[model samples]
Target: MVHLIKTQSSSAKSRMGPASLNPDLPAVAGLGSFEKLNGFFNAIYDGPTEDPPWHSALNLLCETLHAKHVTLILKPPSPVSTGILVNTDAVAHDATEAYQNHFFTLDPFVGLPEGQVVTPEELVGDKVWKQSTLYREYLKPLDVKFLIGADIQTADGIECRFRVSRGGDIPFSADDIALCRLLLPHMRRALQLHSRLDGLETERQLFAGAVNSMQLGTISLAHNGAVIDLNPEARRILAEKDGIQISNNVLCTDNRREGHELQRLIKEALSGSAGKKGPGLVEALALTRPSGRSSLGILVKEIPPSPWTVNRQRAAAVIFIRDPEASVAETSQKIVQQLFGLTRIEAAMALSLANGSTIEETAENLGLKKNTARTYLRFIFNKTGVTRQTMLVRKLLGSVASLG
Candidate 1:
């Protein structure tokens, strides 16, 4: 059994009161119940940045309601297998797996009419529940005598189940059921938040992977000029200490004049005034390297506020840096030479043109005559099946050739 365990809160056990009198009628929960619940809510809200330590919260729920054991299961219908989110250690792993594989079909709670919170006693009479195979054979072996569960979600044919079970013959009181009902909304919201955060994290990882693969340095900034996050490439540039580095969590360059200019651009972008000229305007600057190598190309672009922009604390502007002296260009050259079967000179010319250079500029850069450069460009156009220079550059850039 794959158990995702989280330890219980310290106060959870102490705050939970014993089983009350009049097990059939409702009773008011204690004053300390609200404080105990606040801890669970904190875990739920923290779920996006980190996995919430929900075991403590679930343990609190079981203890608060006087249930011996509890389990929460989130599963998609049919093709997708079920997963146990939380399970109290009181139940053996083997017993849980056995119930999951075989006894699940016999569960009276499986097809209970869709409702808020329902107990076995409410769904089926105590006599009828006792007579069922689920109790006589499966649950009897596990020693679970009573159960209370809620259907949290049943969207798109996927069902999420939250259930608490008690041992021995002592039945749950009305207060236990009411407590479960009270806790249902919090549990439901936490699950939804978990799902949303999972999606956002996956997208962030995918984007980060793509950016890293291309050797593009990306730095996300807060409104106050603090560094929110930096990709691997950005870190590499900062470590080089040739041109750019992060000081005081702010982007800095070796040259004081250049640094001042960069800071001004960053501030402008953060202020949401960088695009005042038009929409989606990207401010560009170049940082001179100490080694006198190719200057690093940097672009600071303002990002409009979105639903994901939490109070504009972070992600106000994004700085994209490109290091021309890096091995990325060499890798791209190799890829172009291999894929297009071009000579080294021809490959260099093709990449240069794709990077928005004119034929004259390509010739000058490669130390070749205008006619020789034109011949190479013509050959590239023929091989790539494009007549226009613009189309040829587009083809080369769009292909896997430029991904190096």
Candidate 2:
């Protein structure tokens, strides 16, 4: 299934890498700079997006060394390409995204000869660098000159190799390669931190998704008693202070006593106890939205972790809201079928309406013709004696919405 067809490209002709690990290179890098770079990497690695701000670090390295520009080229996940990880102090800023998105897609720099030590004389001398397509599209406009690099074994994956580049007209000296060897530790640690931060962000999003998928009123409160997150059910109970702020541990008059109990339960769970996870004497919280109303019970549990991944010792608590009252589905059926005596299909249409779906959406989902859906709406109106969707929803919700 794998093929290695040779291409008559300039990079193919040059095929450069280190000749050998330099003897004078420091065995270990400085620890203080490594920690600082690690911290920066962690901050961005936890971002919601895949691309981290590694270019900034490369810029710092460039500034410190008085280099014109520095680029960190990461070998692609596949052997077919080279991806630019960081292009700091770039010359062709306009083409930066293009290089990252497309140029690197074909750059022959990735599949360069591995294992043996290489030098510029091996990869590109005078003629080959001028003819390479990647240099023309990415490096030419940027005025890139001298290029020195090292291929590192990536910690996570095989196809991934690390290379740092200093761009200029002058050729790199042996001392320059030694300098890079000195800085390799910082680069490796930075990448590892980025990997960990990415894991944390993914965990957060997964937790959020789990919270939303539950048929419960859930709220995540920060350590300082301020609410940081809320699902639909919990939002209503918190009364969403300022139309956005909501908390599980809210100090509202309606659920003050209950919120206090929930907070105590969280405290217990954080203090190495499971808290009252059983069906205890806690009362369900009332939810009143404009569409439907229901009651929600609460449960708290710890986020799962392996032995080494114990970052959340006293971090956020996972709140589970269980609707004791009828769910949104049940509420919609109760309102549309019981009150209006509509057929199950017609009741489903009305139920979908209650969930904020437009008529077209409801009809498409049920595989019913739009006109037929309209007819059912008419019948619902005639039976319930309500002229509009808003009125129907209001009648069911009764100032309290179901968390369904």
User: Global lDDT for candidate 2?
Assistant: 0.54
Error of 1 at 148 (Å): 2.3
lDDT of each: 0.72, 0.54
Off by over 4 Å in 1: 1-53, 76-84, 88-109, 119-143, 154-158, 306-312, 325-383, 387-394, 399-404
Model 1 pairs whose backbones collide:
none
Q: TM per model? A: 0.66, 0.56
The CA lDDT at 322 in model 1 is: 87
Residue-level error in angstroms, candidate 2, position 212 = 1.1
Best by lDDT: 1
Task: Tell me the RMSD of model 1 versus the true structure.
Answer: 9.1
The TM-score of candidate 2 is 0.56
Candidate 1 residue-wise lDDT, 1-404, digit = tens: 11212333456445543322223212335524444555656754554344333666666666666677887776622324444545765667887777767777777776544436677767787788899998899877777788877777734343578778888777766556665665666667667777776778899898787777676899999888889988888888888889888778877789999999999998888887878878755568999998898999999888778866568575888999988756543346778888888888888888787766889998999999999889988888887788998997777756776445
